[model samples]
Target: MINWYPGHMAKAKEKLKENLKVVDVVIELLDARIPFSSRNPKFDSLIGDKKKVIVLNKMDLADKKITDIWVKRLSEEAPTVAINSLNGQRINLMISKVKNLMSDKLNQLKRQGRRKKPIRLMIIGVPNVGKSQLINQLCEYGSVKTGNKPGVTRGQQWIKMRKDLELLDTPGILWPRIDDEEISFKLAATGAVKEELYDSELVGYKLLKVLKDIISDTLEEQFDLSQVNNDTLELMEDIGRRRGCLMSGGKIDRERTGNIILNEFKSGKLGRISLEISSN
Candidate 1:
């Protein structure tokens, strides 16, 4: 079992509940590559009765066909849009959907002859899922600090995007306990959890296992392997040898090799791969 709920995340969860009273809508960002595993199950209870717009970030790094399937499936539950935050793809469509969701409430307020208010949105997701980057793209400036690693944002801050739009950026929070091992591996593989918390070699091997089944041709082509074998460990060793991740005694440096594989996968050097696919 892999469990990592830090002190700050606990506090962040409480803060989110309290802040929920004020926000009008929730923008739940998810990793497009691992949509199922990236979602925190606790959010359903936490975001009770609030309108939600699911934004699948990092679409540029995920398989396009898989992402389109996910978008269609997820839209049945809420307004879903696939966006590449780094390049601002489909961002305008997201904003339009949010506005549409709130159109009724906005019209009601107008009927009462009340003053116009900004649409308060809270952005929530697992760590390093591109919440900060999404906010920056919406604002067209870097209003918050961002890093490739998890646990970058430690507090809540309100950002003004426009006269009628306001965004609340919250720290990424995970569930108290992740009982599912496959979910844990997916989280670790996608950088949702810190690299120091788990064994990278094991995660890398698991990643290879998934890739070999889904995109064996791409994997072999990327690593210059003649063929992909059933033994993932042997495949890792072969990759390490090809990439020169070796120790002084002619042994493969497993840690270094693991990091290399993970970095390449995360950076999309292994091609556009989606760890999870929509069944529909």
Candidate 2:
């Protein structure tokens, strides 16, 4: 369940309109695990006819098979690349791709005698998808503050990375409307939404159910279970037992176990898993 936009997010809509005209290209980041759900329906309308490139970040943490499927699926409209921004090495390739795609604008600027000016690119995405990290990586670990939590970027700020490239790092923005329940669940289950509204036990159970369908053997191995079981609760109990999360009276600490499972999944210890699968 996605919580509605906060008061701060309302201001983002105003800021978005404020800066839309100045941006030459829009680098919209999509979480590789939940491409469709992570996409804001209003993006096309918000971005208008501006050059758009979809950066599928956190590829290292997502199921490769599913990522490939999404790549093929999303390639129909925008140029898409699967990248791990934390690693830094993949960023150059991403920048090169963006530069190539925005060459028409570069030519137009050249004709106007402003070719040497850095290309202004606006980076926008939902909170916590590594947008700030990507910007710092692209600019060689420069001055912008980087944090694990969302909304570190505030107001309109320009950072010059290279002689020909400048970045306008804006705060992460979410849409005002989230109409799909399934999308909300996937987002919540994966911690792509906020953590305050999520119950670790519920999310873990949901994740186990999904893994059992897609990668049962991996899930079984990770939790040290001998066999795949029909019941999710039974599997979670086994996981808790293996992890030694027991209460004072020796009862299984389901909530603790759930937190551990979800943490491992978030940290990529449960291997690359994708909550949302793309339709062909």
Candidate 3:
């Protein structure tokens, strides 16, 4: 169900490669909740040996313990900082980490008497991972348009933020296909993938199943169900009945119920959840 839509990917890769030569560091944004699923696999190969700071954006929505585990794992590879891009939380930490990571390069520039130039940074991430929102936080002002859905920034555009920083804004890109079915569902569940690419009912049902295993008690508490059910669809029906997502003839509107469940999960109304855990 993953749609490649390679035109943007190819263009992004080309533009990224061309710009990579000029940038001092790359701000690789990952959804704190789905660090594994939201990450573009090609990003590693595409950004080989480049100085990168992994900013785990939207940390506010993620489970703290799981996010801490992710930070520990990812920091082994690159400087990882957890942040909430929407309200500029921990943004300064990200800025400082970027500066710390680029210290050597900055020193080299100082040796050459060329500290006049800004540290060029390009923010890259999966769709809806808050690249634009992160940019706004960094600049402390709105510079790029942002949306909850994918592919808002359609072309390559550069924005000058801090006197010492310049950002290249590009449309969010995902791999044409995903190797793991679970990862695909996780991406679809987290709104990382386009709605049209996957069946919401299927993904929502899968989400409920996962929640049933991990946080069934929370579900029972949230939906006020007398008892949790093993059947995912039955649980959805129960939720629909509670949420009043009904159709004509008083039938459970599975579609709307599914959306409510997903939206609740996404909005953290259900609970702070982490879909992918560290293999370690």
Candidate 4:
């Protein structure tokens, strides 16, 4: 599945490059389940020589054990924090980490006898990874509308986070090309792309299969789906039957089955599951 970047994301990419010059630090948000896939490909180079704080967002929806693995893995590359963008949870820790990364920069300015300036940080992430949600949490008292749909943010804007820290929130950017099948599968599985990439039914079935393999009894417990002796398709059919998605001839309605499964997973009804696990 080769994913093409949308026109709107192209403008964000250009703006991201231009805004990099004014940023002293970068805060990149990655989906906790698929950290590598959630990252913007151009991030490292775009942030060159600047301090970075990689935030693994949506932690509540990911496997806690896998999240720990990613936290350790990413910490080796840069300072990493696992946070739930909702409820303003773990955001203060993120603020503290960013302040630490820019400590030297702040001291450098002081050495030059320059007045202290607000810590300038650029926030970047792929669409739907919770960058805007995190920003809204950090600036909850301020006027900002947060949504589940991607691309709600249209242009660049700066918001104050703390006494001496200013955040430049940019529109989320997806890369111009998606060349890896494994990555595409992971992204589609995780709801990163719009629902157009794959059949919703297929995606939902895939989610159930994945859940059966990893969490075992998770699907059965959540959806009241019974454990069946049959194969994956049969199990999906059972789910379809339970949900009353049946064709006129009495066949399971696959399309509705798919939508139900995918929606349930997205809404966290399938439980706190992570699609990807660490190799190490």
lDDT of 1: 0.90
Among these predicted structures, which one has the highest TM-score?
A: 1
lDDT for 152 in candidate 3 is 74
The lDDT values for all models are 0.90, 0.78, 0.84, 0.81
Which model scores highest in lDDT?
1
Worst 10 residues of 3 by lDDT: 136-145
Full ranking by TM-score:
1, 3, 4, 2
Over 25-125, each residue of candidate 3 has an lDDT whose tens digit, in order, gives 89899989889888888888878888999988888889999999999999999999999988989888888998897788778888999746777888989
lDDT of 2 by residue, 106-151 (tens): 7888899974557788888887888877887777435678776566
Residue 246 C-alpha lDDT in model 1: 91
The list of candidate 2 runs beyond 4 A from truth reads 111-115, 177-179
How many clashes does each candidate structure show, in the order listed? 0, 0, 1, 1
What digit string (tens of lDDT, one per residue) describes model 4 on residues 1-280?
7466889888878888888888988988899988988877788887787788999998998889999999998899899999999887888898889889888878999999999999898888888888777877777357566777767776788888755778888888888888876677667777777877667776677666776787667767765765753477888888888889999899999879888878777777778888778633
How would you encode candidate 1's per-residue C-alpha lDDT over 42-146 as one tens digit per residue? Answer: 898999999999999999999999999999999999999999999889999999999999999999999999998999999999998999888888774456788
Better of 2 and 4 by TM-score: 4
